[model samples]
Target: MNENKTHDLEKERQYYTNQTKELLQNLKEINEQKELTESELREQVMARIGAEKQLQAAEKALEHLEMALKMTGAQMTELQEHIMPDVHKLREYFEQCAQEAQLEANRAGIMRQAIYARK
Candidate 1:
């Protein structure tokens, strides 16, 4: 009977040891999973920050492009305004030259008539 008692106690001890080992393995797996989750979270945060920076850069570039376009429009308006007076003066000069040529031609015709009448 004493030998049987020792045999039962040994079986109980083996069962407890197996339970402890399983619990330890479960705790280790939980810790490893937590670390992996933390690492993934860190990666996601870094990626978000990088995307935000790129978005800001794109916005800044758009602003510069808009400013440049506005400047080009303003320059075009200034050039048009600056050249209008020269265009008007050129038109007037051509008109004046046409009038003077007409007057000289009429005078030459009158002089020829007088010379031919005398002859």
Candidate 2:
């Protein structure tokens, strides 16, 4: 009877030891899965942050472009309203000078032809 009790206790001890080893293996697997999930979450967070920064930079660049476009529009307005009339007046004066010079050139050519005929 004593031997039977000792044998039963030994079997119980072996079973518990096996159960403990299995539980430890399960805990290890759970820990590894948790670590993988955390790593994935960290990577996702970093990617989102990078994308948000890029979006902000894009918004800033668009603002600069809008400002530049506004300035260009203003410059165009200034040219059309203030400078085009002066440019047109200068163009008319230049045309008048060109016409007078052409007339003088024609007169000089006629005089040269007459002198050649006389010679």
Candidate 3:
């Protein structure tokens, strides 16, 4: 009877040992899964932060472009109001000079023809 009790106690101890090892393995798997989830969450957070920074930079660039457009419009207005009239006046002056030169050439040609006829 004493030998039977010792044998039963040994079996119980072996069973409990096996159960403990299985529980430990389960705990390790749970920890690994948690770590993987945390890593994925961290990666997602970093990606979101990068995207936010890019959005901010894009917003800043848009603001600069808008300012440049406004300045360009103002410059165009100035050119149209103040400088275009002078350019048009110069063009007219050049046209008038060209007309006068053409008239003089015609007069010279007419004089030459008249001289040739007389001859």
- Residues 18-117, model 3: lDDT tens digits: 9999999998987786666556655655665565565556556555654554567664786556655655565565556556555655655565465445
- Local distance difference test, candidate 2: 0.64
Per-model TM values vs. the true structure? 0.53, 0.58, 0.55
TM match of model 3 to true structure: 0.55
Error of 2 at 24 (Å): 0.3
In model 3, the runs with Cα more than 4 Å from the true position are 74-119
> How high is the lDDT of residue 104 in model 2?
55
Q: lDDT, candidate 3, residue 3?
A: 100
Give me candidate 2's TM-score against the actual structure. 0.58
Candidate with the larger TM-score of 1 and 2: 2
- Ten residues in a row with the worst lDDT in model 3? 110-119
Q: For model 2, how does the per-residue alpha-carbon lDDT over 63-119 read when each residue is reduced to its tens digit?
A: 565455456765478655665565556556555655655565565556546544543
